[model samples]
Target: MTHIVDAAWQKILTTYGEPVPPDASPLLEPFAVLARVAHAEPLLRRLHPWTGMWELHFSRCTEMNYTWDLPYIGTLRDGRYYVEGPDRSSPRIAETDSAQAAVAMVVDRLPPGCGPAFLGNAGELAAYEKTRDQG
Candidate 1:
């Protein structure tokens, strides 16, 4: 259930106040709430931006696919890892031999004080700390 309240979509909803139809999938209920929040307060944006990273556990040609959390940073697709954020451009984290190594790069940056460890791409961990502390 990787439902994201995209900021871009929120802007459209705010400007036009469009009607959101009943979703056929119940799993999307949680996401709809977030969407509504975004639509109402488009400037609020995302407090926790690194929330929607997931992995496709299994994808069969004509069978039900499985999904799970990555528990790391960014997304891995087409044999490459990418660090994505709304405020920043999606940079290629790595294209290494070990998947674990790629994930390590992201995990190492999740905490505060990890300055320039990976180029401070995501607003420096300290910035996150300041907001967290204020909240």
Candidate 2:
């Protein structure tokens, strides 16, 4: 039987057009927690281009724009999980012994009034923003 979290992740993968890399297996539990909390939102799992660590991105939209408000979660060399805020130059938002705890931190820190993500590219998101603004 397929688990609900697995099913949800499958949907994200289908929409995201890329399979989770094998090295990301370590992050599955935390990813599942995030997937459960943001079930209605679209999610992206990718390897950070420079660091090559797996990261989970959360997107939210406004009347005129969309941004990944939640920090990405990744593992440190020492095995702790960390949440990095949008401003990479700043200190990490959180670090925890468990990836699930780190993900919980992310959920707790979601921006005020944040809703389900706009499921599209930047242009499509802009179009959506335009329509919403016009209404």
Candidate 3:
């Protein structure tokens, strides 16, 4: 089963002094856990478009899962943490520490307007923040 998060409705509640849905599951719970380990580090507190989603765009020229079952997270035989997104190319993120910190480093290093497109979801963003807190 899939979980849906009504972020816009929640925003309305906060702004209009309405009650939040008591049944609302914390959004991005599963994905955040994966993104935490996959991208490492978690969301940036100061970043704009603050949905806190962690996004990775794969090259169209590469051969791999473009969207589904992609962004594989694991260790090489040498014991380094790495994630292979839909691009089929593997990018090593960290070794001695959790990769979440590395993700933060990456986002920090991006030039203006050079960031990825998948990082805009608010639920995902919140999940990233939650992941950082848990780690």
Candidate 4:
């Protein structure tokens, strides 16, 4: 069967140039934790930086339906994937066609309270890494 984590695994391989542990290729704990703590305030702020302040109200709808105030990022039509890390030097890619799914996947793999800072833009993500590398 095709696995959602395959693509994320491929990404990890390409980025790290190494193979992941068989059982540890995709971490699942963080995702579950994040799901439990899912809320819109922080996510909304991260997703929309230009707005001064915003309010989110859950409404019944299809495309943009949310239980919280965060914007719709995207859904994973083909399931989802994940990657976990203690790698402090990893580069964070801020944009993807399936950014929502991707973030969920990564969250699944991460440890609780280990959320990465969403830089709000591609340039910001890049700059974060560049600055980290320089130090």
Best by TM-score: 2
Point out where model 1 deviates above 4 Å: 1-78, 84-90, 113-135
> Each candidate: RMSD to true structure?
15.6, 7.9, 15.0, 17.8
Clashes of 4: 3
Over the full model, what C-alpha lDDT does candidate 2 score relative to the true structure? 0.51
lDDT of 1 by residue, 1-44 (tens): 11232443444345334443575333233333333432343222
Worst 10 contiguous positions by lDDT, candidate 4: 49-58
Residue 35, candidate 3: Cα error in Å is 1.5
TM-score of 3: 0.26
Weakest 10 consecutive residues of candidate 2 by summed lDDT: 43-52
Estimate, for each residue in 68-100, the C-alpha lDDT of model 3 and write its tens digit.
222333333333334443234555443433346
Q: Candidate 3: deviation at residue 128, Å? A: 30
Estimate TM-scores for all models: 0.26, 0.52, 0.26, 0.22
Query: If both were scored by lDDT, which would come out higher, candidate 1 or candidate 2?
Result: 2
Native-referenced Cα lDDT, model 4 = 0.30
> How well does candidate 3 score on lDDT at residue 14?
41
Model 1 lDDT-worst window of ten: 55-64
Candidate 3's clash total is 9
Report the lDDT tens digits of candidate 2 across residue range 44-114. Answer: 22111112245555545322233544566666555567788764565788777775576567667766655
Model 3: how far is 80 from its true place, Å? 6.7
